[model samples]
Target: MSDNLAIRKIIHIDMDAFYASVEQRDNPELKGKPVAVGGSRSRGVVAAASYEARKFGIRSAMPSVTAFRKCPDIIFVKPRFEVYKEVSQIIRNIFFEYTDLVEPLSLDEAYLDVTNNKIGLPSATLIAEEIRKKIFDSTALTCSAGISINKFLAKTASDINKPNGMKLIKPEEAMAFIETLKVKDFFGVGKVTAEKMKRMGIHTGLDLKNKSLGFMTKNFGKSGSFYYNISRGIDDRPVNPNRIRKSVSIENTYDNDLSDISHIETELEKLSESLETRLAKNKIQGKTINIKIKYADFEQVTRSKTSQYWLSKSTDYQPLWKEILLDERLVQKPIRLLGLGLSNLNTEEKENQGLQLTLEF
Candidate 1:
């Protein structure tokens, strides 16, 4: 590839039927039938399922009883987390051999940045194919690979082909490819955002690309800019090894010392735009919203809010922001550096015991 623009060579690797495949590798009879790895009927959820299980609409996280309803002949295998972890390590080690920029989303999937790799391979496609072969050779497992210029595109491309397959998205063809993609298919555009975009007639990349960036920004907050860029296949993001946000924050160092109330608002607007992008990309719901201010004299103070719901997206900030911005103490400060960070991770346990009670899924 030409080095004119320094595009990132990203590849997303996903193992096929991860847990189920491992079970089938050792069990001869389970090779061709629909298989689920999890608890048996009457309790527990399906952690993984073979392709045959997918055919019967038996999916991971479904109740064991539900899976039975989907496919009466479905076979349920207990989860062996230790074995899966060992296999995951093997694959991860192989990835490090090609590139240190490997970001694992889960045991079964990872994103690798091979722009500057250890082996100096000429093509990312070759790297992906070689990796696939190595995985199968080592574990007797089939995996899917996606090669593209950015993480988002690569992740999407990985799902296009399954069961030991590969799909490459070149820079030259990116725009045309994105034009046909559904809005929901875009990485990071979840159900809520997709529905919101749909209401605004943003059904596909082509439709999203046709809308003004300003409009998207107004409606979706900071993520709107990223969505606009991605729809046009103009993503400039790198293949980061650590994609998870430890904290989501937006800060600005103003050109001049700001004392006026309007000045603070203007800087806040810019920061809000940037902050929203980071939060949406990671899909992390934050509990605390922290505000930091540094005065001209170098004094800094931070204020935080603990929210009940995980801040799912930038839109979730609306309620929190109204409270924060209206606070008299924070608004009175002559801010030089203004920042916002979301942290305090809190997760909710599943109310429904997915598989513990039913032999479903």
Candidate 2:
């Protein structure tokens, strides 16, 4: 870990229960109540849960019925995506006031490189505080922030004191902080990966740091190198403001499994139409068409075919679906879910010219 590598000042800002918060903010009657932003229908899923709802173990992507079971008084509200998007843009404009080096992870969270800010601020902590305040003043919403030398640390730190709070990890303290952090708490380590690491006796950042690079790469494949670097407070990746969309996909989970081939084909046609609309919305074209099938028993598999010419319309890729569905493996069992996606996009190889800036503290 060289001193020069820790020169950048990064901040991660994440809104507190974004969707639910917006719903509560707009409708005061919903305030301080257990609120889940989603449908309450039989196949409904929760998109977001307010802090009040979270006390009952309500969470996003949870079944609405399960949420109701947890808290009988829970209120389910439909999502207003257009309103959320408008608020997101307002917050993005605030970030541009300080620096153009802003990378949005989603509508509610973003990574900002304020090392060399427009206002020439020397303290990243101050910048984060100011940003949080401005977001609240504009949206009547609160947010949490993390300030550190790089994106990884900043992202991890943001969750430490969440819901309208901020934390800073200075360059010198980065390694010590990470070493004591749980392996499950690491930014990219999901549930399955955490379980795998636990089985391997890698339960914490220190345990991860103790493993040889060869041992890690052997076990985790490509991501092993990333884990190795971050364990020692090393992440050189830049804050890419112009992040490209790698793929466009649409998936549907049915209330009941479909065993009939005709019914499956009809569902595939609907998915193809949705995928095409999304591609056209984003102006995306790709060479690879993919299908994902999830069986009633939870077994899932994907099939893909690549063509020399780009495909963007539903008709262009629907023919490929029939070719893929001919596989014997697909009809062996009833399918509970079907997905269609396009990848190897026209924009895949294109790179945005980014500005390089530095700060002296």
Candidate 3:
């Protein structure tokens, strides 16, 4: 490692099953029991699953119905965002006391660069321990911490021990630690990319490191270079504290594939309402509306329309959803999923006399 890299101390903090844990903490009866937060037993998706639920293959983003099938006795709890948000703020406040270079990934996870910190702690490991302890002390919740030179290694280390565990990857051990890492375990290497890597005879970080940079770029395009650098444990991405949200959206998968236009319309209405709720909560509106449809065969299509001005009303989006659905060539196909989104974000408000007419073919 270079001198600059050696001196950098990065830490990744992830709360242990945040939503479910919060529910369990607030309700003493739920302790040590399988719990899921968000969605219901009948429809929608699992937002988060407790570690207890994970034993039966339950996970976030899995359909709630599927989660039910996996763990018949699993308890489902509706999300309490107000409570989650408050806990998140408490955690964030703890992080800010350690370093200003805190980049939050979500309500439960964040990256903190402590090369230079407020408390003048020399060891990043100690800083991580202190932060984790402070989080528990403040919220009565546990978090996992990873200490390393960069975000990737720190994040990977955090997962090594989970649910109130901490792990560190020292500079001297970084190379060896990376060598044994499977390609699938690398950040940003999804199932599709892992399959592609396997087909290319790259199975481990060592295999990736052995390939020429040119060979990687030729095969994987922009991501090839990323893979190459990470295999050697070199990631220079900074902890950006000022990331902005460019869009807000909501999506759902039904218990049965929706076939008729009427059913699809009903689903769209629900999706639109959900999207509006999210937008209103975020206090944002957008000029663009996007509709996503997934067929029963897994084929998906997205259609979008950008208005001249930002719109926050569900009334403005409902007609556009109908237009997109009617205009789609695959309208006759059974729809398995529906999604609605808003982009081209605008925070400024314009006085609306009523719904302004703006639609183009």
Candidate 4:
């Protein structure tokens, strides 16, 4: 490890079932129930599941019907995004009180670099505890926190003790902790990758660490170096406050696949309108209009067209959507999902957003 690693402090704070927790906090009747915040329709998906709901295997992004099947009495609540955003801002304000180097992963989670905090705190663990207490006092919401030398380790540590708990991985203990860590628990290693690693006898961080750099590179390409480094507890990524938004998109999966061209086109138009509203709300414009189609057989394809001028209105992309949908291959199969997105955004330009790292004792 480098000398800089020993001097840095990072914290990952994740709200406990944020959406459902908010609903439960607002309604007394939902306090201890298996509450899922989302639509209850057959095509609906769970945006978040309370801890009670999680016991029944309910999880975010799960199909509502499947969640219902898992737990017949699960209460489904509609999401109040405005309320969530308001609360998120309040939490972010609390984070800013400690450090401006806060990187929000979502409305429910963020990373904080507090090696040099506003109040001149010496321990990252205490700061995490104070933040969690303030969050509970303000929002009646519990959050879990992880403290470590780097973002990846801190993120992993946060999950160790969940639902209003905190865990710290000291600089010296990082390697030992990671050595025994499950491969699946490593950040960025998905189910498919975990299965592949298991097949290759890489079930733990130590197993991954045992592989030669050249061998890992040969198998996993560029990502092999990332895996190798992180296995040994080396993550140099800074806590970026001004993380850029890569794209703006809207997508929907229908309960029933649409075979008719007219129906598909109508849905596409609706998506385009929704995308326009979102883009207008965010004040984002892009030169590339992209469409994604997923067939009933699970095959997916994406098509994109780059325009000379920036596009933000529905009318601007409706023609491109029609042109993209005109393909015979798309019409041959019934589509289960339709998505529209804009990329190469106006905010993609480079800027001086570097962090001002300091070590204040």
Best by TM-score: 4
What order do candidates take by TM-score, descending?
4, 2, 3, 1
Assess candidate 1 and give its TM-score to the true structure: 0.66
Error of 4 at 174 (Å): 0.4
Number of clashing residue pairs, candidate 1: 17
Write one digit per residue (lDDT tens) for candidate 1, span 28-84.
899999999975755456789999999999888676778998898998897788999
Tell how far residue 354 is off in model 1, in angstroms: 43
lDDT of 4 by residue, 209-229 (tens): 999899889988898998999
lDDT of 3 by residue, 61-89 (tens): 88777899999999999889899999999
Candidate 4 — worst ten consecutive residues by lDDT sum? 352-361
Q: Per-residue lDDT for 1-361 in model 2, tens only?
A: 4455437889999999999999999999999999999858454568999999999999997877789999999998988999999999999999999999999999999999998899989889999989999999999999999998888999999999988899999877888998999999999999999999999999989999999999999999999999998998888777888888788898877887889999999999999999988998999999999998877776789999988889999889888889998887798898877889999999843344334444542
Q: lDDT of model 3 at residue 49?
A: 93
How many backbone clashes are present in model 2?
Answer: 0
- Clashing residue pairs in candidate 2, if any? none
lDDT of 4: 0.88
lDDT of each: 0.79, 0.89, 0.85, 0.88
User: What does the lDDT read for residue 185 in candidate 1?
Assistant: 89
Per-prediction TM-score to the true structure, in the order listed = 0.66, 0.90, 0.84, 0.91
- Give the least accurate 10-residue stretch of model 2, judged by summed lDDT: 348-357
Clashes of each: 17, 0, 0, 0
Task: Please identify which of the two predictions, 2 or 4, would achieve the higher TM-score against the true structure.
Answer: 4
